[model samples]
Target: MKLIAVTNDRMSIDELIQTLLAIEPYIDAVILREKSKTDTEILKLIQKLKEVNFNVKKMIVHGKPTIANTEQIDKVQLPGGLPLPDLMRQYPALLFGKSVHSLEEAIVAEADGAESVLYGHLFKTNSKPGLQPRGTDDLRRIVSSLTIPVYAIGGIRPSHIERLREVGIAGVAIMSTIFESEHPKNIAKEYYDAIHT
Candidate 1:
Protein backbone atom coordinates (compact mmCIF):
# COMPACT_ATOMS: atom_id res chain seq x y z
CA MET A 1 0.00 0.00 0.00
CA LYS A 2 1.24 3.48 -0.88
CA LEU A 3 1.30 6.19 1.77
CA ILE A 4 0.31 9.71 0.70
CA ALA A 5 0.79 12.71 2.94
CA VAL A 6 -1.80 15.49 2.77
CA THR A 7 -1.34 19.08 3.92
CA ASN A 8 -3.60 20.15 6.80
CA ASP A 9 -3.79 23.88 5.89
CA ARG A 10 -2.57 24.72 9.38
CA MET A 11 1.07 25.49 8.68
CA SER A 12 2.94 28.49 7.35
CA ILE A 13 4.63 28.09 3.98
CA ASP A 14 8.04 27.75 5.54
CA GLU A 15 6.89 25.19 8.10
CA LEU A 16 5.06 23.20 5.44
CA ILE A 17 8.05 23.18 3.14
CA GLN A 18 10.41 22.01 5.87
CA THR A 19 7.95 19.36 7.04
CA LEU A 20 7.43 18.10 3.50
CA LEU A 21 11.13 18.03 2.82
CA ALA A 22 11.71 16.08 6.01
CA ILE A 23 8.99 13.54 5.28
CA GLU A 24 9.37 13.24 1.51
CA PRO A 25 11.52 10.15 1.61
CA TYR A 26 9.02 8.21 3.68
CA ILE A 27 5.93 8.90 1.57
CA ASP A 28 4.96 8.64 -2.07
CA ALA A 29 3.25 12.01 -2.63
CA VAL A 30 1.97 15.18 -1.00
CA ILE A 31 -1.48 16.60 -1.69
CA LEU A 32 -1.44 20.41 -1.42
CA ARG A 33 -4.88 20.77 0.17
CA GLU A 34 -4.71 24.33 1.36
CA LYS A 35 -8.23 25.30 0.40
CA SER A 36 -8.13 28.86 1.77
CA LYS A 37 -4.93 29.81 -0.05
CA THR A 38 -5.41 31.99 -3.15
CA ASP A 39 -4.04 31.18 -6.59
CA THR A 40 -1.11 33.56 -6.19
CA GLU A 41 -0.41 32.17 -2.75
CA ILE A 42 -0.52 28.66 -4.12
CA LEU A 43 1.80 29.73 -6.93
CA LYS A 44 4.21 31.18 -4.39
CA LEU A 45 4.07 27.96 -2.38
CA ILE A 46 4.95 26.00 -5.50
CA GLN A 47 7.74 28.39 -6.33
CA LYS A 48 9.19 28.11 -2.85
CA LEU A 49 8.95 24.32 -2.98
CA LYS A 50 10.80 24.32 -6.30
CA GLU A 51 13.44 26.66 -4.90
CA VAL A 52 14.20 24.07 -2.24
CA ASN A 53 14.49 21.37 -4.90
CA PHE A 54 11.41 19.62 -3.51
CA ASN A 55 10.09 16.90 -5.80
CA VAL A 56 7.32 18.88 -7.51
CA LYS A 57 6.43 15.71 -9.38
CA LYS A 58 5.29 14.25 -6.06
CA MET A 59 2.98 17.23 -5.52
CA ILE A 60 -0.69 17.01 -6.41
CA VAL A 61 -2.55 20.33 -6.43
CA HIS A 62 -5.90 19.87 -4.72
CA GLY A 63 -8.89 21.45 -6.48
CA LYS A 64 -6.68 23.71 -8.56
CA PRO A 65 -6.35 22.66 -12.18
CA THR A 66 -4.88 25.95 -13.41
CA ILE A 67 -2.10 25.88 -10.82
CA ALA A 68 -1.27 22.30 -11.70
CA ASN A 69 -1.16 23.19 -15.38
CA THR A 70 0.87 26.32 -14.89
CA GLU A 71 3.38 24.58 -12.64
CA GLN A 72 3.45 21.40 -14.72
CA ILE A 73 2.69 19.39 -11.58
CA ASP A 74 0.93 16.74 -13.71
CA LYS A 75 -1.69 15.82 -11.08
CA VAL A 76 -4.82 17.46 -9.70
CA GLN A 77 -7.38 16.14 -7.26
CA LEU A 78 -10.84 17.49 -8.10
CA PRO A 79 -14.09 17.57 -6.22
CA GLY A 80 -16.68 15.03 -7.29
CA GLY A 81 -19.11 17.73 -8.43
CA LEU A 82 -16.71 19.15 -11.00
CA PRO A 83 -17.26 18.46 -14.68
CA LEU A 84 -14.45 15.93 -14.88
CA PRO A 85 -14.82 15.12 -18.56
CA ASP A 86 -14.58 18.77 -19.48
CA LEU A 87 -11.53 19.25 -17.26
CA MET A 88 -9.87 16.20 -18.78
CA ARG A 89 -10.56 17.59 -22.23
CA GLN A 90 -9.23 21.03 -21.31
CA TYR A 91 -6.11 19.67 -19.65
CA PRO A 92 -5.25 16.67 -21.70
CA ALA A 93 -1.70 16.42 -20.40
CA LEU A 94 -2.68 16.43 -16.73
CA LEU A 95 -3.85 13.48 -14.68
CA PHE A 96 -7.00 13.95 -12.60
CA GLY A 97 -8.21 12.23 -9.47
CA LYS A 98 -11.75 12.78 -8.20
CA SER A 99 -12.58 13.19 -4.52
CA VAL A 100 -15.61 11.00 -3.90
CA HIS A 101 -17.86 10.16 -0.99
CA SER A 102 -19.70 7.16 -2.39
CA LEU A 103 -19.40 4.13 -4.61
CA GLU A 104 -21.61 5.77 -7.24
CA GLU A 105 -19.37 8.81 -7.32
CA ALA A 106 -16.29 6.62 -7.70
CA ILE A 107 -17.82 4.72 -10.58
CA VAL A 108 -18.87 7.89 -12.33
CA ALA A 109 -15.46 9.45 -11.83
CA GLU A 110 -13.71 6.46 -13.37
CA ALA A 111 -16.08 6.50 -16.35
CA ASP A 112 -15.45 10.21 -16.75
CA GLY A 113 -11.73 9.50 -17.21
CA ALA A 114 -10.29 10.19 -13.79
CA GLU A 115 -6.96 8.43 -13.30
CA SER A 116 -7.87 7.69 -9.70
CA VAL A 117 -10.44 8.44 -6.96
CA LEU A 118 -9.91 9.57 -3.35
CA TYR A 119 -12.67 8.11 -1.15
CA GLY A 120 -12.99 8.73 2.50
CA HIS A 121 -13.64 9.62 6.08
CA LEU A 122 -13.70 5.84 6.42
CA PHE A 123 -12.97 6.22 10.09
CA LYS A 124 -14.36 8.74 12.57
CA THR A 125 -12.14 11.80 12.70
CA ASN A 126 -11.72 15.20 14.32
CA SER A 127 -12.01 16.66 10.85
CA LYS A 128 -15.68 15.64 10.74
CA PRO A 129 -17.03 15.87 14.26
CA GLY A 130 -20.32 14.17 15.13
CA LEU A 131 -20.79 12.76 11.65
CA GLN A 132 -20.73 8.98 11.25
CA PRO A 133 -17.78 7.49 9.43
CA ARG A 134 -18.45 5.76 6.10
CA GLY A 135 -16.70 2.61 7.49
CA THR A 136 -14.77 -0.18 5.78
CA ASP A 137 -17.78 -1.95 4.27
CA ASP A 138 -18.70 0.95 2.00
CA LEU A 139 -15.03 1.44 1.24
CA ARG A 140 -14.68 -2.21 0.31
CA ARG A 141 -17.65 -1.96 -2.00
CA ILE A 142 -16.25 1.10 -3.69
CA VAL A 143 -12.87 -0.55 -4.09
CA SER A 144 -14.37 -3.68 -5.60
CA SER A 145 -16.46 -1.62 -8.00
CA LEU A 146 -13.80 0.67 -9.35
CA THR A 147 -11.26 -0.30 -11.98
CA ILE A 148 -9.06 2.73 -11.36
CA PRO A 149 -7.03 3.30 -8.21
CA VAL A 150 -8.99 4.03 -5.00
CA TYR A 151 -7.12 5.85 -2.24
CA ALA A 152 -8.82 5.81 1.19
CA ILE A 153 -8.61 8.99 3.25
CA GLY A 154 -9.68 10.39 6.64
CA GLY A 155 -8.59 9.55 10.16
CA ILE A 156 -6.30 6.79 8.99
CA ARG A 157 -3.51 5.49 11.20
CA PRO A 158 -0.56 3.21 10.62
CA SER A 159 -2.41 0.55 12.64
CA HIS A 160 -5.30 0.54 10.15
CA ILE A 161 -3.15 -0.20 7.11
CA GLU A 162 -3.48 -3.96 7.22
CA ARG A 163 -7.26 -3.89 7.24
CA LEU A 164 -7.25 -1.25 4.52
CA ARG A 165 -5.07 -3.44 2.33
CA GLU A 166 -7.55 -6.26 2.89
CA VAL A 167 -10.25 -3.91 1.59
CA GLY A 168 -8.28 -3.76 -1.69
CA ILE A 169 -7.51 -0.07 -1.75
CA ALA A 170 -4.69 1.15 -3.89
CA GLY A 171 -3.26 3.28 -1.08
CA VAL A 172 -4.05 5.66 1.77
CA ALA A 173 -4.22 9.50 1.91
CA ILE A 174 -3.38 10.88 5.33
CA MET A 175 -3.71 14.42 6.68
CA SER A 176 -3.40 15.13 10.39
CA THR A 177 -1.46 11.95 11.03
CA ILE A 178 1.71 13.44 9.66
CA PHE A 179 0.95 17.14 9.33
CA GLU A 180 -0.17 17.68 12.92
CA SER A 181 2.66 15.72 14.48
CA GLU A 182 5.64 17.44 16.09
CA HIS A 183 7.91 14.75 14.64
CA PRO A 184 6.49 14.48 11.16
CA LYS A 185 9.52 12.61 9.84
CA ASN A 186 9.19 9.88 12.47
CA ILE A 187 5.42 9.73 12.01
CA ALA A 188 5.84 9.49 8.25
CA LYS A 189 8.44 6.74 8.57
CA GLU A 190 6.20 4.80 10.95
CA TYR A 191 3.31 5.01 8.48
CA TYR A 192 5.59 4.06 5.62
CA ASP A 193 7.01 1.10 7.52
CA ALA A 194 3.50 -0.10 8.34
CA ILE A 195 2.41 0.04 4.69
CA HIS A 196 5.55 -1.59 3.34
CA THR A 197 6.33 -4.13 6.04
Candidate 2:
Protein backbone atom coordinates (compact mmCIF):
# COMPACT_ATOMS: atom_id res chain seq x y z
CA MET A 1 0.00 0.00 0.00
CA LYS A 2 1.06 3.59 -0.60
CA LEU A 3 2.08 5.38 2.59
CA ILE A 4 1.36 9.10 2.74
CA ALA A 5 2.24 11.15 5.80
CA VAL A 6 0.09 14.08 6.86
CA THR A 7 1.68 17.03 8.67
CA ASN A 8 0.27 18.44 11.87
CA ASP A 9 0.30 22.03 13.23
CA ARG A 10 2.13 21.25 16.42
CA MET A 11 5.64 21.17 15.01
CA SER A 12 7.90 24.03 14.04
CA ILE A 13 8.77 24.50 10.35
CA ASP A 14 12.31 23.23 10.86
CA GLU A 15 11.07 20.21 12.75
CA LEU A 16 8.59 19.50 9.98
CA ILE A 17 11.31 19.57 7.33
CA GLN A 18 13.61 17.35 9.35
CA THR A 19 10.88 14.80 10.01
CA LEU A 20 9.78 14.74 6.36
CA LEU A 21 13.34 14.35 5.09
CA ALA A 22 14.06 11.57 7.55
CA ILE A 23 11.07 9.53 6.40
CA GLU A 24 10.82 10.55 2.75
CA PRO A 25 12.48 7.40 1.51
CA TYR A 26 9.94 5.19 3.28
CA ILE A 27 6.75 7.17 2.63
CA ASP A 28 5.19 7.69 -0.78
CA ALA A 29 4.22 11.35 -0.28
CA VAL A 30 3.76 14.10 2.30
CA ILE A 31 0.47 15.91 2.45
CA LEU A 32 1.16 19.49 3.62
CA ARG A 33 -2.09 19.95 5.51
CA GLU A 34 -1.06 23.04 7.46
CA LYS A 35 -4.44 24.69 7.49
CA SER A 36 -3.46 27.09 10.25
CA LYS A 37 -0.80 28.77 8.11
CA THR A 38 -1.70 31.67 5.91
CA ASP A 39 -1.71 31.21 2.13
CA THR A 40 1.48 33.26 1.78
CA GLU A 41 3.18 31.30 4.56
CA ILE A 42 2.18 27.99 2.99
CA LEU A 43 3.33 29.12 -0.43
CA LYS A 44 6.67 30.25 1.01
CA LEU A 45 7.11 26.91 2.72
CA ILE A 46 6.27 25.17 -0.54
CA GLN A 47 8.81 27.30 -2.35
CA LYS A 48 11.45 26.64 0.26
CA LEU A 49 10.78 22.92 0.03
CA LYS A 50 11.32 23.07 -3.73
CA GLU A 51 14.40 25.22 -3.30
CA VAL A 52 15.83 22.49 -1.09
CA ASN A 53 15.09 20.06 -3.95
CA PHE A 54 12.62 17.97 -2.03
CA ASN A 55 10.42 15.83 -4.29
CA VAL A 56 7.61 18.33 -4.73
CA LYS A 57 5.71 15.78 -6.77
CA LYS A 58 5.40 13.77 -3.58
CA MET A 59 3.92 16.76 -1.80
CA ILE A 60 0.20 17.41 -1.78
CA VAL A 61 -1.11 20.86 -0.87
CA HIS A 62 -4.29 20.71 1.15
CA GLY A 63 -7.06 22.83 -0.47
CA LYS A 64 -4.65 24.97 -2.46
CA PRO A 65 -4.97 24.27 -6.16
CA THR A 66 -3.55 27.66 -7.11
CA ILE A 67 -0.38 27.04 -5.13
CA ALA A 68 -0.21 23.54 -6.58
CA ASN A 69 -0.57 24.94 -10.08
CA THR A 70 1.92 27.71 -9.42
CA GLU A 71 4.52 25.33 -8.02
CA GLN A 72 3.64 22.60 -10.57
CA ILE A 73 3.04 20.27 -7.68
CA ASP A 74 1.36 17.10 -8.90
CA LYS A 75 -1.18 16.55 -6.16
CA VAL A 76 -3.75 18.54 -4.19
CA GLN A 77 -6.05 17.15 -1.53
CA LEU A 78 -9.18 19.19 -1.03
CA PRO A 79 -10.55 19.52 2.47
CA GLY A 80 -14.23 18.95 3.15
CA GLY A 81 -16.69 21.58 1.73
CA LEU A 82 -14.15 23.51 -0.37
CA PRO A 83 -15.73 23.84 -3.82
CA LEU A 84 -13.88 23.99 -7.08
CA PRO A 85 -15.40 21.93 -9.83
CA ASP A 86 -13.60 20.44 -12.84
CA LEU A 87 -10.17 20.61 -11.17
CA MET A 88 -8.69 18.63 -14.05
CA ARG A 89 -9.68 21.30 -16.51
CA GLN A 90 -8.07 24.08 -14.47
CA TYR A 91 -5.04 22.16 -13.32
CA PRO A 92 -4.25 19.79 -16.13
CA ALA A 93 -1.02 18.34 -14.76
CA LEU A 94 -2.26 18.01 -11.19
CA LEU A 95 -3.97 15.07 -9.50
CA PHE A 96 -6.73 16.08 -7.10
CA GLY A 97 -7.85 14.20 -3.98
CA LYS A 98 -10.57 14.72 -1.42
CA SER A 99 -11.26 13.90 2.21
CA VAL A 100 -14.56 12.12 2.65
CA HIS A 101 -16.40 10.61 5.60
CA SER A 102 -18.90 8.24 4.01
CA LEU A 103 -19.79 6.25 0.90
CA GLU A 104 -21.95 9.09 -0.41
CA GLU A 105 -19.15 11.64 -0.07
CA ALA A 106 -16.68 9.24 -1.61
CA ILE A 107 -18.87 8.78 -4.68
CA VAL A 108 -19.41 12.51 -4.95
CA ALA A 109 -15.67 13.17 -4.72
CA GLU A 110 -14.89 10.64 -7.45
CA ALA A 111 -17.53 12.27 -9.63
CA ASP A 112 -15.88 15.63 -9.07
CA GLY A 113 -12.64 14.65 -10.85
CA ALA A 114 -10.89 13.55 -7.69
CA GLU A 115 -8.34 10.95 -8.69
CA SER A 116 -8.07 9.73 -5.10
CA VAL A 117 -9.91 9.98 -1.78
CA LEU A 118 -9.01 9.82 1.93
CA TYR A 119 -11.76 8.24 4.04
CA GLY A 120 -11.80 7.49 7.75
CA HIS A 121 -11.85 7.99 11.48
CA LEU A 122 -11.55 4.21 11.46
CA PHE A 123 -10.32 4.08 15.04
CA LYS A 124 -10.30 6.39 18.04
CA THR A 125 -7.65 8.99 17.26
CA ASN A 126 -6.26 11.40 19.85
CA SER A 127 -7.06 14.34 17.61
CA LYS A 128 -10.68 13.33 17.29
CA PRO A 129 -11.79 11.88 20.59
CA GLY A 130 -15.27 10.69 21.50
CA LEU A 131 -16.27 9.94 17.92
CA GLN A 132 -17.42 6.58 16.63
CA PRO A 133 -15.13 4.87 14.19
CA ARG A 134 -16.26 4.29 10.62
CA GLY A 135 -14.76 0.77 10.89
CA THR A 136 -13.51 -1.62 8.20
CA ASP A 137 -16.97 -2.62 6.92
CA ASP A 138 -17.73 0.87 5.62
CA LEU A 139 -14.16 1.09 4.45
CA ARG A 140 -14.72 -2.11 2.44
CA ARG A 141 -17.84 -0.73 0.86
CA ILE A 142 -16.16 2.54 -0.05
CA VAL A 143 -13.20 0.74 -1.55
CA SER A 144 -15.42 -1.68 -3.50
CA SER A 145 -17.69 1.07 -4.81
CA LEU A 146 -14.93 3.28 -6.20
CA THR A 147 -12.49 2.68 -9.00
CA ILE A 148 -10.20 5.44 -7.75
CA PRO A 149 -7.68 4.86 -4.98
CA VAL A 150 -9.13 5.13 -1.46
CA TYR A 151 -6.58 5.93 1.24
CA ALA A 152 -7.78 5.25 4.76
CA ILE A 153 -7.01 8.09 7.19
CA GLY A 154 -7.30 8.84 10.91
CA GLY A 155 -6.25 6.52 13.73
CA ILE A 156 -4.28 4.20 11.47
CA ARG A 157 -1.69 2.16 13.30
CA PRO A 158 0.80 -0.51 12.26
CA SER A 159 -1.47 -3.17 13.80
CA HIS A 160 -4.36 -2.03 11.58
CA ILE A 161 -2.55 -2.94 8.36
CA GLU A 162 -3.86 -6.49 8.00
CA ARG A 163 -7.45 -5.38 8.39
CA LEU A 164 -6.91 -2.47 6.01
CA ARG A 165 -5.36 -4.75 3.43
CA GLU A 166 -8.27 -7.17 3.78
CA VAL A 167 -10.69 -4.28 3.34
CA GLY A 168 -9.07 -3.47 -0.03
CA ILE A 169 -7.67 0.03 0.54
CA ALA A 170 -5.05 1.44 -1.80
CA GLY A 171 -3.13 3.25 0.94
CA VAL A 172 -3.26 5.25 4.16
CA ALA A 173 -2.70 8.86 5.30
CA ILE A 174 -1.40 9.15 8.84
CA MET A 175 -0.86 12.28 10.90
CA SER A 176 0.50 12.53 14.47
CA THR A 177 2.08 9.10 14.12
CA ILE A 178 4.94 10.11 11.84
CA PHE A 179 5.10 13.81 12.65
CA GLU A 180 5.16 13.29 16.37
CA SER A 181 7.33 10.20 16.53
CA GLU A 182 10.74 10.57 18.21
CA HIS A 183 12.14 8.27 15.57
CA PRO A 184 10.20 9.02 12.40
CA LYS A 185 12.62 7.02 10.25
CA ASN A 186 12.05 3.81 12.17
CA ILE A 187 8.30 4.42 12.40
CA ALA A 188 8.09 5.06 8.66
CA LYS A 189 10.02 1.88 7.95
CA GLU A 190 7.67 -0.01 10.20
CA TYR A 191 4.65 1.46 8.42
CA TYR A 192 6.08 0.59 5.00
CA ASP A 193 6.80 -2.97 6.03
CA ALA A 194 3.35 -3.33 7.50
CA ILE A 195 1.78 -2.31 4.22
CA HIS A 196 4.07 -4.23 1.90
CA THR A 197 5.08 -7.34 3.86
Candidate 3:
Protein backbone atom coordinates (compact mmCIF):
# COMPACT_ATOMS: atom_id res chain seq x y z
CA MET A 1 0.00 0.00 0.00
CA LYS A 2 1.32 3.46 -0.92
CA LEU A 3 1.23 6.23 1.69
CA ILE A 4 0.62 9.87 0.77
CA ALA A 5 1.18 12.30 3.67
CA VAL A 6 -0.43 15.72 3.32
CA THR A 7 1.00 18.99 4.77
CA ASN A 8 -0.98 21.68 6.55
CA ASP A 9 -0.60 25.18 5.12
CA ARG A 10 -1.75 26.86 8.34
CA MET A 11 1.29 25.66 10.24
CA SER A 12 4.55 27.60 10.17
CA ILE A 13 7.16 26.43 7.72
CA ASP A 14 9.27 25.12 10.58
CA GLU A 15 6.36 23.09 11.94
CA LEU A 16 5.50 21.86 8.49
CA ILE A 17 9.09 20.78 7.86
CA GLN A 18 9.18 18.94 11.16
CA THR A 19 5.96 17.14 10.32
CA LEU A 20 7.21 16.23 6.86
CA LEU A 21 10.52 15.02 8.24
CA ALA A 22 8.80 12.88 10.82
CA ILE A 23 6.66 11.07 8.25
CA GLU A 24 8.85 11.17 5.11
CA PRO A 25 10.72 8.03 6.02
CA TYR A 26 7.57 5.90 6.02
CA ILE A 27 5.40 7.22 3.20
CA ASP A 28 5.69 6.91 -0.58
CA ALA A 29 4.81 10.55 -1.25
CA VAL A 30 4.36 13.94 0.41
CA ILE A 31 1.43 16.09 -0.73
CA LEU A 32 1.85 19.78 0.10
CA ARG A 33 -1.78 20.94 0.33
CA GLU A 34 -1.05 24.55 1.10
CA LYS A 35 -4.49 26.06 0.99
CA SER A 36 -3.60 29.38 2.67
CA LYS A 37 0.09 30.05 2.09
CA THR A 38 1.20 32.25 -0.75
CA ASP A 39 3.13 30.81 -3.67
CA THR A 40 6.42 32.22 -2.37
CA GLU A 41 5.91 30.58 1.00
CA ILE A 42 5.10 27.25 -0.58
CA LEU A 43 8.13 27.49 -2.87
CA LYS A 44 10.36 28.30 0.07
CA LEU A 45 9.13 25.23 1.93
CA ILE A 46 9.76 22.99 -1.08
CA GLN A 47 13.25 24.42 -1.54
CA LYS A 48 13.97 23.94 2.15
CA LEU A 49 12.95 20.29 1.97
CA LYS A 50 15.25 19.80 -0.99
CA GLU A 51 18.10 21.74 0.68
CA VAL A 52 18.02 19.56 3.77
CA ASN A 53 18.69 16.48 1.65
CA PHE A 54 15.27 15.03 2.39
CA ASN A 55 14.46 12.38 -0.19
CA VAL A 56 11.00 13.79 -0.97
CA LYS A 57 10.32 10.98 -3.39
CA LYS A 58 6.94 12.21 -4.65
CA MET A 59 5.25 15.56 -4.06
CA ILE A 60 1.62 16.47 -4.80
CA VAL A 61 1.21 20.22 -4.93
CA HIS A 62 -2.42 21.34 -4.57
CA GLY A 63 -2.85 23.49 -7.75
CA LYS A 64 0.17 25.65 -8.62
CA PRO A 65 1.08 24.29 -12.04
CA THR A 66 3.70 26.94 -12.83
CA ILE A 67 5.53 26.47 -9.53
CA ALA A 68 5.08 22.72 -9.68
CA ASN A 69 6.73 22.77 -13.12
CA THR A 70 9.72 24.83 -11.91
CA GLU A 71 10.12 22.83 -8.68
CA GLN A 72 9.89 19.55 -10.58
CA ILE A 73 7.98 17.52 -8.03
CA ASP A 74 6.47 14.16 -8.87
CA LYS A 75 2.82 15.17 -9.41
CA VAL A 76 0.11 17.76 -8.93
CA GLN A 77 -3.19 16.66 -7.29
CA LEU A 78 -5.92 18.86 -8.71
CA PRO A 79 -9.12 20.00 -7.01
CA GLY A 80 -12.32 18.04 -7.73
CA GLY A 81 -13.88 20.47 -10.23
CA LEU A 82 -10.90 21.52 -12.39
CA PRO A 83 -10.60 20.41 -16.00
CA LEU A 84 -7.85 17.79 -16.09
CA PRO A 85 -7.45 17.92 -19.88
CA ASP A 86 -6.65 21.62 -19.92
CA LEU A 87 -4.12 21.28 -17.12
CA MET A 88 -2.69 18.08 -18.53
CA ARG A 89 -1.73 19.86 -21.72
CA GLN A 90 -0.13 22.66 -19.73
CA TYR A 91 2.07 20.33 -17.66
CA PRO A 92 2.61 17.25 -19.68
CA ALA A 93 5.79 16.57 -17.77
CA LEU A 94 4.06 16.22 -14.38
CA LEU A 95 1.52 13.63 -13.28
CA PHE A 96 -1.98 14.98 -12.75
CA GLY A 97 -4.12 13.80 -9.82
CA LYS A 98 -7.85 14.30 -9.30
CA SER A 99 -9.99 14.41 -6.17
CA VAL A 100 -12.80 11.95 -6.75
CA HIS A 101 -15.72 11.28 -4.40
CA SER A 102 -17.73 8.67 -6.21
CA LEU A 103 -17.58 5.82 -8.72
CA GLU A 104 -18.87 8.03 -11.52
CA GLU A 105 -16.23 10.64 -10.72
CA ALA A 106 -13.55 7.96 -10.67
CA ILE A 107 -14.60 6.80 -14.15
CA VAL A 108 -14.68 10.36 -15.38
CA ALA A 109 -11.25 11.11 -13.93
CA GLU A 110 -9.76 8.12 -15.69
CA ALA A 111 -11.40 9.14 -18.96
CA ASP A 112 -10.01 12.66 -18.53
CA GLY A 113 -6.48 11.25 -18.27
CA ALA A 114 -5.86 11.76 -14.58
CA GLU A 115 -2.72 9.98 -13.46
CA SER A 116 -4.48 9.06 -10.20
CA VAL A 117 -7.59 9.79 -8.15
CA LEU A 118 -7.99 10.42 -4.41
CA TYR A 119 -11.33 8.91 -3.32
CA GLY A 120 -12.72 9.93 0.01
CA HIS A 121 -15.19 9.41 2.92
CA LEU A 122 -13.98 5.83 3.07
CA PHE A 123 -14.43 6.18 6.82
CA LYS A 124 -16.16 8.85 8.85
CA THR A 125 -14.20 11.65 10.52
CA ASN A 126 -14.45 15.31 11.54
CA SER A 127 -13.59 16.17 7.94
CA LYS A 128 -17.10 15.09 6.99
CA PRO A 129 -19.12 14.25 10.05
CA GLY A 130 -22.61 12.72 10.08
CA LEU A 131 -22.05 11.18 6.69
CA GLN A 132 -22.32 7.48 5.95
CA PRO A 133 -18.97 5.75 5.80
CA ARG A 134 -17.91 4.52 2.39
CA GLY A 135 -16.86 1.09 3.59
CA THR A 136 -14.54 -1.42 1.93
CA ASP A 137 -17.30 -2.66 -0.35
CA ASP A 138 -17.86 0.80 -1.80
CA LEU A 139 -14.12 1.24 -2.28
CA ARG A 140 -13.74 -2.16 -3.93
CA ARG A 141 -16.39 -1.27 -6.45
CA ILE A 142 -14.77 2.06 -7.29
CA VAL A 143 -11.34 0.48 -7.58
CA SER A 144 -12.74 -2.13 -9.91
CA SER A 145 -14.43 0.52 -12.03
CA LEU A 146 -11.40 2.70 -12.61
CA THR A 147 -8.27 1.90 -14.56
CA ILE A 148 -6.18 4.64 -12.98
CA PRO A 149 -4.77 4.26 -9.50
CA VAL A 150 -7.25 4.91 -6.67
CA TYR A 151 -6.11 6.46 -3.39
CA ALA A 152 -8.32 6.05 -0.32
CA ILE A 153 -8.59 9.32 1.54
CA GLY A 154 -10.50 10.92 4.45
CA GLY A 155 -10.48 9.60 8.03
CA ILE A 156 -8.10 6.77 7.24
CA ARG A 157 -6.47 5.15 10.25
CA PRO A 158 -3.80 2.50 10.73
CA SER A 159 -6.44 -0.07 11.61
CA HIS A 160 -8.55 0.64 8.52
CA ILE A 161 -5.70 0.72 6.01
CA GLU A 162 -5.15 -3.03 5.86
CA ARG A 163 -8.70 -3.63 4.67
CA LEU A 164 -8.24 -0.96 2.02
CA ARG A 165 -5.11 -2.71 0.76
CA GLU A 166 -6.93 -6.03 0.57
CA VAL A 167 -9.14 -4.54 -2.14
CA GLY A 168 -6.15 -3.34 -4.21
CA ILE A 169 -6.18 0.39 -3.51
CA ALA A 170 -3.11 2.03 -4.97
CA GLY A 171 -2.49 4.19 -1.87
CA VAL A 172 -3.96 6.17 1.03
CA ALA A 173 -3.85 9.95 1.38
CA ILE A 174 -4.22 11.18 4.98
CA MET A 175 -4.41 14.39 6.94
CA SER A 176 -5.58 15.17 10.57
CA THR A 177 -4.98 11.63 11.81
CA ILE A 178 -1.33 11.60 10.85
CA PHE A 179 -0.81 15.34 10.91
CA GLU A 180 -2.19 15.75 14.43
CA SER A 181 -0.37 12.84 15.99
CA GLU A 182 2.45 13.52 18.46
CA HIS A 183 4.73 11.02 16.77
CA PRO A 184 3.69 11.23 13.16
CA LYS A 185 6.56 9.11 11.82
CA ASN A 186 5.58 6.31 14.15
CA ILE A 187 1.98 6.79 13.07
CA ALA A 188 3.17 6.67 9.49
CA LYS A 189 4.99 3.45 10.27
CA GLU A 190 1.71 2.08 11.60
CA TYR A 191 0.07 3.00 8.30
CA TYR A 192 2.94 1.47 6.34
CA ASP A 193 2.61 -1.73 8.31
CA ALA A 194 -1.13 -1.83 7.72
CA ILE A 195 -0.62 -1.43 3.99
CA HIS A 196 1.74 -4.39 3.81
CA THR A 197 0.12 -6.64 6.40
Q: Pick by TM-score: which candidate is best? A: 1
Off by over 4 Å in 2: 84-88
lDDT of 2 by residue, 47-118 (tens): 777777788778999988998888888889988897647667777887889999999999999888788989
RMSD to true structure for each model, in Å: 0.8, 1.4, 1.5
TM-score of each: 0.98, 0.94, 0.93
TM-score leaderboard ranking: 1, 2, 3
Candidate 3 per-residue lDDT, tens place, 1-197, comes to: 68888775568988888888777878899888988898998999999988877775567788787888888886898888888999888888988888877888889999999988888878887767799877677778888888888888888888876667779999898888887778888888888887767
Q: Which stretches of candidate 1 lie over 4 Å from their true place?
A: none
Residue pairs with colliding backbones in model 2 are none
lDDT of 1 at 34: 94
Rank by lDDT, descending? 1, 2, 3
Which of candidates 1 and 3 reaches a greater TM-score? 1
13-118: candidate 1 lDDT, tens digit per residue: 8999999999999989999999888899889999999999999889999998999999999999997688998888899999999999988888889999999999
Per-residue error (Å), model 2, residue 143: 0.9
**Model 3 ranges with Cα > 4 A deviation:** none
Instruction: Indicate whether candidate 1 or candidate 2 has the larger lDDT.
Output: 1
**Which residue pairs show collisions in model 1?**
none
